[model samples]
Target chain A: MTSLPATTERRLGLVIDLDTCVGCHACAVNCKEWNSGAQDSPLSDVDAYGADPSGAWLNRIHTFEVTPEGAPAQIVHFPKSCLHCDDAPCVTVCPTGASHKRSEDGIVLVTEDMCIGCGLCAWACPYGAREMDPVENVMKKCTLCVDRIYSETLAEEDRIPACVRTCPSSARHFGDFNDPTSNVSVLVAARGGIDLMPEMGTKPVNKYLPPRPKTNAATRTDPARPAAACQPDTPRPEGFLGWLDAALDRLG
Target chain B: MHPAISVIFFTVASGAGFGLIFLLGLGFPVGGGAGRAFAVSLAGGGLAVAGLIASTFHLGHPERAWRALSQWRSSWLSREGIAAIATLGLFGIYALVWMWSGSRLQILGLLVSLGAAATVFTTAMIYAQLRTVPQWKTRLTPAVYLSFALASGWLLASALGNHAAPGPWGIALVILAWAMKWAWWVRAGRTRLADSGSSPETATGLGFIGKVRLLERPHSGENYLTREMVHVIGRKHARKLRGLALALGAVLPVAILIITALTNAPAPVNLLAALSMLAGLLAERWLFFAEAEHAVSLYYGNR
Candidate 1:
């Protein structure tokens, strides 16, 4: 089962819009909250409330500064999770049958029971997509919210992955990449979505839309138009005061 | 690339142990005749078993380790585990046959020879097949491993053989293994960040944006990915360790072997040569893991 299926019926993944993301980390927080106690969950924390709290998180938001030649700098928020590559090296390198990709959907998952936690799957991934649960002694990864995405118990509108559903800027979109007309596929085509580390040749299912260029006109400050203030309509003040106010108005 | 101590010892001990098995299977004249198998069965077999036990210590679930052998079809780690088991099984039969019947079976010897070499090859492939680590992703990785296995095995063979002078073939194998190791060091020296074509620009998919810089990290504290993959050793310190490994693992053992060939061979001196080789190669194996830079570290700007 560690050997990937030749082809999946569908390639379900995400398309993240860097231009729209606000770097709030809401998606990452919600993902952790939802996964920690889901059906197959309990992503443990190393230090909960101590000086430096660290834990196993399936999603993380990285912020990068991009400076184009002779162009203003742009700050982009990159939220990374499992890309679920078509040629996922993580799945093949697993010595146990725990790491696998679904044949029906291209989502790669780890069956916690069978994982030996040898960390080979994590090592094979060029992207840091997998983590070991220090407390649970098992490999933890983004399951694309496998439990919530297919649950009949949840409402119809709430079936998407926790990260996609909780994105405040609507930067994250989840759909099947196999469908040419899917929302993600359409967005990727329109925005020139790209794979991170394409030279790795993992054929990642997730796509990232680059941040749009910001020109001078977009960033320059605009002067405000003057507006008349309400007048009391009272008789003019003393001659000197009136003359002073008129002089200031002339200067303005 | 974190050089876990358990894995370092496992590779060093088992590498030499299996090498000795390969030589034994070929009926190399180690103290000649009946009891040779029994002595080696204790020395080489004990070291191999110790190394295997040490390997399990690094696993998160040692009790579930048996399941690792079940996925040999695609995983090199699985293949290594299965090959190790088979090699040891074959060596066991070979040893017992000689002890019980005073007859060395040619078929069993040939099987052990193939099995031992296969086990070491699979072990080397476990590291070489990882494309995420560019330094270990070459055919030379296995070549280095095989040569070291043979050279270290020769050291033990020299110690165990009854001949007054160590064989020229043993000395030749040692020199050959060091030459390969020296070549490996030169190739790996610049491999940390250069020559891999993977840079921070390539890693973030922002090469067209002029340049990319890390403005903020995902977390302030250490995570599993960083802890496991981003082991940083100072360049100066690594250079010194390489020197230590080369001196102890190669130069000293060769000098001792040459001295034995020219003069009377003290059994103690030969034993010292084998022990010295083991100690030296341990440093070499440690450096092997310490110097490996994972491609995933590019994401964190650590590579």
Candidate 2:
């Protein structure tokens, strides 16, 4: 059962836009809120009101400072979770039939009932996607909101991952990547979305849209002028200007 | 990666046990007069079983461990579980037949010995197959494991043997294991593959645009992933431990083993050598996990 299926009928995944993410923790918070009450593997927290609080969360957002050669440094907000890789190592490494990828939708999931919680699946995942819940004593990861997406009780428009639905900047997109006309696929094609750590050969289903290139006007700004130029070295003028200059000098 | 004590104990103890069983299967029954062979067998089997049980103690659900044996088709861990169980079963049968019939069942003994070897190999593969820890994904991982196992087995056999003089084979195996371990350290230290492949740029798919560094972590507190994977050992401490491992595990054992063989020392000397080697191997095993950098650690700037 650990062996992966030869193929899936549809590859459902997420596409995130780095250009628009605002580094807010809404998606992660919503993920915690929804999955905490999920039908399977409900998330739990330890030391919630104590000195060191920690909990299980399916999604996390990170902030990074990128300094390119010959380019100005930029801050990028990065949200990360399980990519539900086509060739997920976590699935293959599970000793029990706990970690498995669905052949129907290509979504990797952990069967809590079967899991031994040996932590091998977590070790095999290079992306740190899996977390062992201390309370349940089972491995937990992003389920791609399987419950919400397939729920007949929910409205059609609300049938999406909690993270995607709660993203304030609309940075997260969800759809079937196998469908060429899917919104995620179109976005991937338009923005040149890339896979994270392709060398790992996980064949991650999620694609990340790179930050958009800086505008010409921003890039073309003169670098030679010193910012101190706003305060002129010329002697104060004789009238109101002189008085203003004296006030500014006193403040400085 | 954090070097869990239970795991280190499991690998070392089981490796020696399987190695002892392998030697016994090869028809090298302890030469010491009466009941020595039975005692040795008991010791080996006890060590193996105890190590296995200890391994389950760290699992979140030890009672569900039986399920681990069901996924051998793709999981090295499953293969290991199967192999260990098979090896133990065959060893038990071989022991019973030897006790009742007073004859070594050559074919069954051989099969059991091969199963022991297979168990050790599967154990090695559990770490070697992991792409997440590049340092462990190497041919040397298994080589070091097998050689060390065989070497420890020989040392234990020499100690338990009735003969006054130590065998040359024990010393030779010790040297071989040491050399292999040395080669592994050199390769692991020199190879760029051991370096972290996942960077901020790769994690965010922003390398094409600029150099990337972590400005802030996702949460204020450590999560399970960080607690389990993002281990950081200081360079100075690592170097000191490496020297200690080499000296205690390889150098001292080889030297003591050579002295014992040359002087035709008593069985106690052989026992001393075996104990020293086990101590060294324990340290080596600890370092093996402590030094391995998981790719997930890149996100935490631990890499």
Best by DockQ: 1
The number of the candidate with the highest lDDT is 2
lDDT of 1 by residue, B228-284 (tens): 887776233777788888888888888888787777667457778778888988888
Docking class of 1: medium
Model 1, span A108-186: residue lDDT tens: 9999988888898999999899999888888999999988888999998899999999999999999999999999999
lDDT per residue (tens digit) for residues A118-137 in model 2: 99999999888999998999
Best by TM-score: 1
Model 1 RMSD vs true structure = 3.1
